[model samples]
Each structure stands twice: as structure tokens, then as C-alpha cells.
Target: MSTSLPSAEPTPSPSRPALRKILHIAFWGVDAQTLARDIQAHALTQPGWTERLHITAHDLPHADCLEAMQTWLTSELQTSGTRPHLSLLVPSGAAQNANAGELQLRNALISAGVSFQVLYGATSEERIRNTTNAIALTAKAILPSSERACFVVSDIAKPINPRMRSWNCEKCSDPECEHRLFTGLLPA
Candidate 1:
């Protein structure tokens, strides 16, 4: 009689798909300390968010913003242990094609195996409103159908005024209100 070999059991695959994590990182033209403080404040307000969500706030020097961003992103990917989606919030004006900085950033991210999207909006009220719309649309377009969230990296120094916040808001009745007149534009 010939000896028979023992049968091996098949390895089981994952039953459910993993939840998609989105990390929004904002790069403000502020000091690193201030950025860290702001991020901490946000984290404190939202309980358990820091653990579950991937929100990051950082400073980006105007001189070499793209290089800085690329380096930071690569570092984050290596350290975070999660392949969360990425979105960059840069001033609309700073995204000019003269230097091709945005293009370089995009290429770097792709080569590093990171999925990313770039959304631009002026700090001004009108432009910010448009940017919000763009952000939403882009999120819908780029995010996979599975569970996902958006992370925003921006240079928004202060909260936007209520009337000017929403894109559909009617013109402010009080013309004298400085907030109403303020466009929230950041320095180029």
C-alpha cells in the first residue's frame, strides 16, 4: 500500500473590505509652532479623531513649498502605516504653471505610491466658496466608492465669515460689515 500525504487547508481571505481612510493635510505659510498648536487645538475638540482620522497641519515656507511638501508627505506615508488618501490645500494663486511645482509634487506622490488630489482656492471669501465647491466635487470624483473621508491642508488663518462661507449665500445686506467685505485672501 502507498503512503498518502496529508491534505492542507486553504487560507481564508478577508471577509469584508477595509475601510478607506482619508487624510487631509493643510500647509499654511505660518510658523511651525503655530501650525502645531492649531492642529492640537483641532484634535482636542474632536475626541478620538486623532486616532481615527488622519488630519495634519503644517507650515510650508513660501520659498520652497513644493519641495517641503513632497518631503513631508513621503515621511508621513512611511511613518503613518496607513495608505490614506491625500488632498493638498494650496492658495489658488500659488498654483501657477510658471515653475511647474504642482506638477512635480504630483509626480513625486505618484512615484511614492500615494494617491493624492490638489484643490486650490483663494483665501478670499468668494474664492474660498468656489474652492469649497471644487473640493467637494474633486472628492467625489477621486475618492473610491468604498468608505472614504477628505483631509484638507490649507493656509486658512482664521475662520471664514458665515455669509461668505457658503457658495449659495446671498449678498450681505450690511455693506459696512468688514467681514462681509473681506475676501479672506492670503498673501501670495
Candidate 2:
């Protein structure tokens, strides 16, 4: 009998790493941060999630304090080239003066030109919809406008006031603008 030749396997080729989209979510409170960590841990342990989009996750851990979160948010806003997407996970009030924490969060975010809304739902679909919307909102997608109109300003110009010390504003908005011209708001 003739000896059969052993089959050869093709060598693997090097390829570029898979692109990953980082969704940086800033927790509004300690409880929220803890819950997020727990969720991440559980998801990683679950086989189903491991098979999904998430492979590995890493971020600078918040120092179990609100100051850390605020600082991180501020720093990211200052440096992130593209419009930074902020996902604020606000937890229910457990402490007696939880409102204080809420207020601090609001102050930090608002001062940085970030707007937010609280979402609560009774059903999974509702929750998902709310969450999708919240993310979209954070990304500055103009949706659910009271006037139900969409506007795009192809020509954007910087207006200068020669009279009053050359008024300078980081951003400008005009709700009355019928065209709904995008006035440097919600770039994300």
C-alpha cells in the first residue's frame, strides 16, 4: 500500500485589531458606580455576554467619591478631540441628603454645557427606549423637539459685536430660529 501524505494546514495571517467603540459612562453617584461595576463583573462572567460585543473593558476607577467623577468628566471634556459622549447613571437616593449629591452633579455637568434627563420605565421595552434616547440625547441628537421640526444650518457665521467689549460666548442657541439652525449645540 502507498503511504498517504499528511495534510498541511494554512498558516494564520496577521490582521489589524478589531475596532472598539468606547462608551464612557460617568456615574452620578457612588451607588450608581458600584452598580455599574457589579453589572460589568456579572456580564464578564456570563458566557452569553462574553460571546457578544464586549471583550475586555478598562477605565480609570472613580475614587469612591463624587469629586473624582466630576474631575474625570471635566478632564475628558477638555481633552477629548471629538464631542465627548456622557452617560450619567443616576441612582436612587439612599442617603438622607442625596439631593446634595444630585445638585453637585448637576452643577458640574451644567457648567460644562452638558444637559441630562432622568428616565424610568416599567417595562423592558420602555427602559430600552429610554436608555437609547438618553444616549442619543447625550450625543446631542436633536430629537423630540416641541415644534417637531428639524433644522440644519449649512452656513454658520460668527457674529461680532463691535460695541460691547466684543461679546464672546462659547456656544450660541436660538430656539426661535425657524430653520432650527444648529448653533454649535449637540455636536455629538
Candidate 3:
């Protein structure tokens, strides 16, 4: 009798899909105080969302911008009677190693007694998209689906090059850009 050959075992594949990073954005108007008040009021009268508000400002440089963000948090404290948890995501600057800036943002939040998280080195166009995606996913977990979200697209002046021109220009010509899909997803 001939000996039979042994069979090889099959390798198993991953059970779940890898999670994509999406930006969870909360858009506030120019008036942070008003926006904060409205959000806090909702938390007080309504039970759908946490009084906690998360903010992500892309490429912001002004003291006023910081103030506005702070205003939003302060309003939540005054109206809802508690400080909201905070997280910040910042893009890497020209130097590529922009973790310093991200640290500054985190430190600012900590100084204010707010818990925060910061993401850095997202300077490239591709990286920016990834970081934003990460934010979206994070926001979805904390906020409700019905909540309106917003993001600030800062200066496109820096990293001025042919490649960037192509990227931005493609958005105008291409219909598949995330901006288009994101806006379309919003309920009227």
C-alpha cells in the first residue's frame, strides 16, 4: 500500500474590515459664545448628546480662532456645568516634523484643564485626507448621526507646487472628491 501525502492547513483571513479614519467635525459659526450656548442648551433640555464638545481646527493661526474655540468650551461649562472633553488634530507644517505644534495645542487644552488628544505630521495632501477621515470616525463615536459637523480648510498657499495645483484642480474637475460626497451626504 502507498502512503498518502499530508494536506496543508489553510490560513485564515482577517474577520473585520480595517477602520478608516474620518473627521468628526462640529461646525460653529463665527460667534463661539452663541454656538456654545446653543449646544449647551441642547444638552440641558435634550438628552441625545453629551454636553462634551470636540473641536478640530485645521491650519488655524489666529489668537481669535483659539479664543472662539475656548469660548465654545466655556459656554458648555457655564450652561451645562461641566467642562467638555477635548481633542485636537493638527497638520505637520513645512518642516514635516510638526509634532511641536500639536504639542502646543494639547498643552493649551491641558492648561485649561481639558482632556485632549493631538495628531501631528499630516502635512501632505494625502495625509490631510487620512487625518480628516480619522476625525470623522472619532466624531461618529462621540456625537450622534443627526448632529451637523463642520471643518475649516485653511490656506492652500503653502507647499505651492505643481503637484498641489493638480490635486486642488482635480477636485474642480473630478466628481469623486470627499468634499463633494460629504456635502451630498448632509440632510437638507
Model 2, span 118-174: residue lDDT tens: 433333334334443444343345324431121122222332211111122333332
Q: Which stretches of candidate 2 lie over 4 Å from their true place?
A: 1-13, 41-73, 76-84, 92-96, 119-188
lDDT of 3 by residue, 1-188 (tens): 01111112233349844332132232211222232333334333323223223332223233334555455445434543334333433333332343443445444455667654433232344333443444445555665565424322133223211121123544555444555546756896
* Candidate 3 runs further than 4 Å off: 1-86, 91-104, 121-123, 145-188
Model 3 TM: 0.29
Ranking by lDDT: 1, 2, 3
Task: Report lDDT per candidate.
Answer: 0.42, 0.38, 0.37
lDDT of model 1 at residue 98?
Answer: 26
Per-candidate clashes, comma-separated:
11, 1, 12
**Tens-digit lDDT string for candidate 1 (1-188):** 01111112234459844332343443322332343343434544443324333444433323356566567667655554555443443322442332444455555566766655343334444344443443344446666644224324244344334332223325434554444455454443
Candidates in descending TM-score order: 2, 1, 3
What residue runs in model 1 are displaced by over 4 Å at the alpha carbon?
1-52, 58-72, 89-92, 96-101, 124-188
